[model samples]
Target: MSSTDTIVHILPPLTNQAQVDETYKSKNVTINTQEVTDRPVLRRDNTGLRNFLADSQDNQNVGYDGEVDTLRRLGRFYNWILTFSVVTRYAFYILPVATLLAIPLSIFATIHKESNIKGIKMMGLFVWLEIVWSSLWIAKLCSKTLPRAFRLCCGVISAGTRKHSLMIKALEVPLSIVFWVIACWASIPVIAAFNPETDVTVLGSNVHWIRSLQKGFLASVPVACVFLVEKVVIEFITVNYHRTQFSARIQESKRRMHLFELLYEASTILFAPYCPKFADDDYIINTSLLSTVGKEIQNVTDLQTGTPIRIFDNLGRLGTGVTSVFGNIVSEVTGGQRVDSKSPHAVVSWALERRPASEALARRVFNSLVSEGNDALYQKDIERVLGPDNHHEAEEIFHALDKDANGDVSLEEMTMIVIELGEGRRAMTKSLHDVDRAIKALDRILMCVVLVGAGLIYGTFFSDNFFKNMSLYTTSLMSFSFAFAGTVQEFTGSCIFLFVKHPYDVGDRVEINNVDLVVEHISLLYTVFRRVDSQRKVQIPNIVNNGNWIENISRSQAMSEHFALAISAATTFEEIENLTEELKEFVLADENRRDYKSDIDVEVANVGDMSKLELKINLGYKSNWSNEKLRVARRSKFMCALLATLRKVQINAPGGGDVAIGDASRPAYSVSVSDEEAKISRMKYLDEKESNKYVKDKGI
Candidate 1:
């Protein structure tokens, strides 16, 4: 290859910066920031009732610090929340100033143009709004501190109340604001009536203005209800999205697995004590050198008296594992579950172990892309390697790497897209892609409902103009919506399939209409599929699946397939019994026990040809049939074992081959040109048999 054509994905030597970066990196990773991001993986579930009550990080992309994990799930947050931060920056400063100006203008106003809102009444409204706004901003600024201070003062920081504080934090600010508003409202009339309505002209004239202030504050009462609804919605999101038991379990599992891996890494380091400690932190204290010095001191102590220093025994145990003091410290520190990620054990393991593993993984990923050299990889090459069953993933990876949209993908492009394909594949199995979309979307949908419902409530019971016009517009809109309902029937059906039925999710292998297909993507109306037979992307409405029988292979466990064969009638019943014994033995073996269930059913299913007897077999796989490689291997091994057993039993085929096998009507297996000589011999025999079957059958 020319120098310009060389791959750009060379792994630079590890440095201090790379080491620092590795310390913070989690094993669960994602690819292109624009396409796929590392959203929290959650188990699929339905929990509407629970959704009515919490905002939790379990379902949200929250970090150890309890902040939204913007580094990972920013896509969902930005897309779902309607943000005009940029637009508001220039316009926001005028709002409070404009309201204050209105208050001053209201003092001279007495005109009412077809409305009850006179200048004095408007003045009351402005004062009321300003007070409420002031209270709200104050509450926001003290929200976190108030919750913490309350919990601290109440002595509720123990493990039992750790989870309870989440709810307290959610309620404290809103409740405090509501209490202050009611206080201002109730105390208003008292202030106006103070000094017994003194005969002094100043005090008597002020009574009218005090009454205006009361009405203004009274108008602000409904704001409390808004806060209440906001609290409820946050709780609802907790139950349904971030803190659902389903999502919580997944997150806990990730943390537990991480802890286990960290423990193992620490154990490995301690097991090999001879390895020199390279860490400056450990060396600064002279922990390793202390042990070495202690060993030498004990050996050479008191040379004139020829006595060893007994203190060396105590010093030697300082950093070394024994009943393992150091090991216990490492485990205790590593196992310590805190909101912070800076565990001492983790730091040691990352510096010594995981960094290398991470680097090795990166090199493997790069090598997979450039192994053929430069830009030799193409769309066809990926499809061929992944196989037709995985055509969907192949297409995704190929398209992601092929930045120019050229037919082929180059080495440089692969540098961007290849990251944790295994983890991504696993994420799909747990319905992560579907669940993540729902986490960000379900709240938005619910919020729209909350808003519309709130509007109707206000318009009907609160507003004179809205009450008169709302009923007519609501009915009119309802009528108009129904008229177009047929156009969105598919969408409605899709919602049912997703939020209700949920038979299969993205990356699930499903069988529809006898064709096995892998789900590539799901939209509201249609689902995209890639056929196992290499057919192109097929887009079908999800509604169609409801009416059809969908064999969800990914979700189903311990799946089995049928095997049938015809044997010559001359082959004794004893031979069939011998074949059953062999099949039983294959499944029961120590190595095969994990692969196949012991209940192997073998029976003479039919005698369709009269001259032959049909042997039917069913072997159940012991696990989920999702791993195609393992499934194929199990079937292939069983078939070979069965065929070898048939030969030992001296069984003959119905069509005259000495060994009984699959029916003659079935397509004969052929070896390719590049196949091994053993397979070629079988192919040669099959060809010769076909050529002289008539003569062989007649004993010519």
Candidate 2:
């Protein structure tokens, strides 16, 4: 038998029983195959493999077409809106200026007409010309479409080939020339049309010149207005059309890609037995395949069926398992309570029930976009997938995907998403290499700019400012100018520096002069850090002149803290050893400390002559150790547990051992001491006191 025939033979046949049962249970309408047609049909239009594939293809084509159409429609709508908006805006601005100019111009025109006075007519003509010029200027200022119109014109003229700056410059030159020509042309006609002989002028000038100029100027108004309006409208329409076309193209691309993705997913699922396993047993199937299925279903269901499904495609098997566990816990916790019924979870579920498939597709698409070069997927593509109504939802998904809050997704982010989606480590090393290169290039460019600016200030402005300040009057002006320029330059430089050189960002724990803090604010001139222990804000200037070390403690792989314990002198070394062992076990058993390397060491720090033993317990914590409160609480609990164990074992000496809590709140036990022990204790006390004094002195 042929492979196709063998596959067909192995395939399961659909039966009406399941559908009938579901309909009966839900009390919904059921379509009976037998009642619908007389022939025994092999394929159903709404279900089965063949129908699914055909429907997918058809839907993809429709989606592409729809996207294009929508883009075109929106572009046209915006163009018209922009045109009318600009015209209205310009009209409002010009009306006031025109009114002011009209008073003076009318008075001059009337005087020039009656007396035939040359001076009066000239004055009136100039006033009228001024009014027209002022009106034009006001219109130019008022037109909201000017900037966008200019940009669109530049873009078109440059054929998208020139740099933005060059295109703007190129367009500005022609626009300025056109404006001047139109203004001159309008004035010339007004000057020529004035006829003082037939007109009356009360003042002593020839009314003919004034009337002639006014008439010419008035005639030019219509021409100028038409030109401006036409330009604005044309630019708006062109831009809108271009945008619409671009959107349509993007939509079409996405639709085709989505169809391909669905096909790939289905094929993967169908031929699971033929695919080879790569690395581990866990790596048998690519998680992207499963996610793709969920994503496709989500997209189709959202677009066609309007259902919402909370898909787990973005999560790895382990992540999915954990998520499922947590979800179950959350459900159980809020299941019966009144609060549960009104919770966001309940709302989400209800929303999901209303549109399961759409929600599922959104989840899947979000995960894919975030995990797979989300930057490559533009806002337009998402709009196409989710439809216009759910564009806001797509935006939320995008924000969630950008976990680092960097405004852009990096390979690390993508890997994290893939890991969550259950895709084992793929070849993502190249992406990291690219990111490193980009960072290095940015740093180099910033360093160059800073050096150049510093050089310029030192050579041209610094020395000159001092010399000019010798004269008080000149000094004041020079100082003001210098200060203003410096301020502007500094502000601009700082903004540029932030984009290029990010020393520290929010949520990063840093250390300055041994004082640990979390970065609270990062500005150009200064960096502010909130002390971890006290939450006090510390400000540090970014001394660009001198390179300073800024330690990022959060980036470290591990952080360690020492716990000192002193036991009674009567307590034997053997007892101390046993106690230390117990402490070690407790610290090691802590889930929080599991990630740390197993290199714990416990030793007698000092032995007191009287009956005291000083022991130091060093513990290391993973960098990812979260829950600061819980960590401290756990340390306290460990100490308490050790104390109880010690008491149970009768390890306490005849004289009670004094316990002192140190770093991480780990307890320290101390015993009574003689002269030598006293010297050690005094020295230790002095060292701590000096440290505190130094901190205070430094204003840290």
Candidate 3:
């Protein structure tokens, strides 16, 4: 068919072909129309759908070009603001130290009555001003968010775009100008007081103008430090302000992105064709549209019912009972939900998840409180377990977890409390463990400071009397006393060393040298253990513990047991090999077997006569199943199953055709440590003993 005829066939014939020709020409399509048609024709609605798609595409493109300028400007402004803010932070750290040093110097000058020096009165006045200023600034910080307080007190926005950023910088100029003016004017008074023309005198002494100016400059040092501090503080506040605003903006952008994606998905779902013409054809619809819709449905339900409902309005209450100002601010900023760290479920969780000694203690406390198979526990029951020092904290935990405020806490409530405690205990244990080092250093330094300060004050006030009264004998006695204190401190130092360096922590099953024990508790001076043999608590000094070989039994995730079986020498090698394979399969089939660990091994343990052939096998299982009683039970069960398998396979012991466990005639026996292993163990023990010489010698 001709191209003209094909076009006519595809599109319906029109009563006015000329109008169709004109429509094609308007759309820039070439068409050959010979003449007008008089036949009445039907028109299909194809153009309607095409026009809709075109308009939708145009709408999506709107405002796209303008967003480029906005993004570029925002990036440049953010980088500039953050860079300046960082430089200001370094100034904050230095200014406070300068102010501190200035205070004593100013006081010393006044006390010595230097020329043109003011009385202690002026020193006190300036110090008082600084104190009041610091206190007020701190009060403002505590009362409001950093950004809000910064804007109010510093007269700056602290964060925003070019115009807004300029406005903030402009607002800060007036205050800065005023501060500089006052600082400069403060020096004029002292300078004029000592000028000959002014004839100024203070405390009945004529002062040189140069001397007055020097004192004036010294006084202004503190004021200038305070000014620098304020400036740094403003920048610090600005940095924080911008960071928080950026975070909020990021969250907003994420939500907008999600919304845009959802819209695109919906459009695709509505516009997509029902079927594809080719296998590799692209679909107009989003592939994940159905999943997105389901997620949206779920999100709507969660928003309507979940914790987020309480977030916006009740967020402030999260910091309700927190004592630290920093703690409160952190809580407020982070939504404050986790402040109740000592609550029952949280504490219990901390114990279990971190597997600390606290877990055992917490469990015992719970069991005692819920005695007689009772469902609930009283607060008093917990207090008894916690003892005096921890009673109040334990009670607070109990009350927080009780939820309904009932005097009794239920088992379910206790479980939840334990779960919540997991995070808290881990954090607290690490903090408490590390705090020893900090406190030790701080105490020694502070003691030295106090002693030196006391000695200086005494010498300054009564040096003549001290020299007159103190003799050679007195000096000798002082030296002996210091030696005695040093000896005592050495012992204390040993305790601190053990606290930080001891290998075994509480709750670990340890073998000290060759003696087995469970660590009951750990203290600075001693480690208390529960003897495995007698179940008696034993307290050993830190020095003694440090002198022993320490081993952690429960630390390994998997445990292995070795068995050497005696097979009848009369049995053929084929029967022995078949039996080994069968046992291997049997052990591997056990539910408790560790998949990641190497499978059970079966091999000849020793070369022997045909009458006493031996097979050695190694079986490893999950460590939790290897506790003493359970381990024995598991071994017995496996042995019985193995003997039964041997009988099924017709493998015989020396005496008869039946398989018998623990019979010398049977095919297997338990294996002990080999000679090589024993030697290595002995050497390790010796090495440990040698390494522990410091602790042992100190104890001696």
Candidate 4:
């Protein structure tokens, strides 16, 4: 073939040849058209050639233009939203401040007997003055855009190392509300104090504390309003923006975890050429270079399928993914490139080849240079976009990888060490198991110590004092023995109930006397549960067995039945069947109900006597599903799906099912416990049934 023909075949056609020519001309890079025809044009600069290839590849992709446009539009939209948020936030802040100042100004005007500035005029002037001051104060406090400030503050607070994020969020709301209220009320006293000639009676007869309190209240109001505004703006941004950011951060973390795994696997795969062996006594241990490859494979599995990693052995720590452990690995391998570390293939290969440590060292050197005066080649952008915690973790990993205790790590050292480590690889499962066993042993020892301490205190003081006053050593000994026995029994019984009864563990669905919850924590003394609907944690005493009926929904034999539906009363039995059929199909189709022994039952529960017919659906499912929220959610979804199906069918045949949808409401459902069940529950109580039955039955 001719050289020109070969060049034509290899070089892809460019749409913007004119633009390319112009760029080359501006850079003083020669591009001979006649010479290009004979051979493929190659840039003298490698970086330039790479950029050209990348740009050309991106241009060929159909989605590239659309993605760019979409990103631009989204950026503009976010900016506009941020601007509006800032304006509205400041406006709300100024309103409260203006109102506070107006009260004092009116009092001053009245005292001066100046009719021009007495009522509305004085109020308007003060309002305007406060508005300007408040705006300026807010602007000074949050110099940047409100959203940015909020993100910074919330991000700082949300770091796990700080106090609980939820508690901080909780405190923000009430603190804002309380301080604003106090500040507003304080204005009344400030006005009275400032204007001595002002009639306190004109304000209110109840305004007794004039000078001292009035000024304090007035001064506090504006200051409080500023703080309140800050809190509100921060919370709004946190809920709407920061939440999504945090979720993105979590996803990014998972992605990095997968990359680390891939790198480990790739490293292992490359190490296959070495075929290193270790000896264990008489047996020659042929450890596969692919032994640690499972972690990488699992990470890839999780990323590809979006399944949570099962790190914990059982459901005790359900949803606690392997990402937590693997996250450290990702941080180490990626070093300064965590954002890009999602590329598992690259990470794995790097790890296998022992090039990651060299890359990490280069990154650090580059960063250090940029920190100095090397601004031309290295910039601030070169520094890793690491979360505060991730940055700290990366530093630790770098130090560990340095090996020789030198400030810097070299590729040769890294490769040699990694190869040695890989050769002697052992499964981490045994170590993890040992750790868990140790923790359990510690807990048991702690519990025994607490019980012994309690017993000692009771015997030493209470027993001696009571018996001494009665003048009987024998009685004291007997009392002490009885007390110790009682304490031991109570403690042991609590532990047994927690372990044996297993009403609810850390992640079980339970109902304490009809109050539904998902167990968050299970301890010897108490169980902490999050109410399924409200997501509020409730502490249930282990001593609840003393009277309260503790129902383990996780272990129930039968599923609780409850459902609501509305249909036109004028509808015939045949028409109702169409609706009921849809409902039945929905319930039966649910994955939760797949293991159900019996089919679902849908009945015309009530004829409202009006125009509507109330229908009840009784769906069956395995009771040990252990998530009441999931149960409710599944039922709701089924109902919605059924309703949609019915609507589709009815669309084809007009008036076939003349059903008027009732006011979208959720009615209360009640479950009745039989007398036998109640009696059985009472018999299990610790205290006398007769004495505390009423309180116990009340579910207190």
Query: Which one wins on TM-score?
Result: 1
Residues 1-700, model 2: lDDT tens digits? 6322332333123233233234333643211100011123332222333233334544655221111112356765655555556566555556666777777667766764543344344544565467456645644443433556656767676766334443334344335434644565445434434554343432222455544544443444444444444444334433443344234544543443343243223333333311222111112221211233234432222334445322222222324334345556866876732323212232222222222322332333334433244444444554455568877755664454444333444433433433322111111222223333433444454555545544444333325564454477556767689657965565555444443344454555666677777766554455567887897888865554125466765445456667877666677767767766765666555342333334566777887775677777776654332235545765676567767868865576546744445735666668877999899989999999987774434564
Return the lDDT, model 3, position 112: 36
Residue range 469-585, candidate 3, lDDT tens digits: 658647786878865785566556644454345465445567777877876665555667888878899998766666667777744455677887776666677877787677777
Model 3 error, position 23 (Å): 72
lDDT of each: 0.52, 0.45, 0.47, 0.44
TM-scores of the models, in the given order? 0.49, 0.31, 0.34, 0.27
Candidate order by TM-score, decreasing, is 1, 3, 2, 4
Give the better candidate number (3 or 4) by TM-score.
Answer: 3
Q: Tell me which residue pairs clash in candidate 4.
A: 186-217, 189-214, 190-214, 190-215, 262-348, 263-347, 263-348, 267-352
Segments in model 3 whose C-alpha atoms lie over 4 Å from true places: 1-502, 532-534, 564-575, 590-598, 607-615, 624-636, 639-700
Q: In candidate 1, residue 629 scores what lDDT?
A: 60
- Location of the lowest summed lDDT over 10 successive residues in candidate 1: 28-37
Give the residue spans of candidate 2 off by over 4 A. 1-86, 112-500, 522-527, 544-546, 553-700
Q: 349-430 in candidate 4: lDDT tens per residue?
A: 2333333333442232233322344322211212232334465444544444444333444434344434433221211222
Error of 2 at 55 (Å): 55
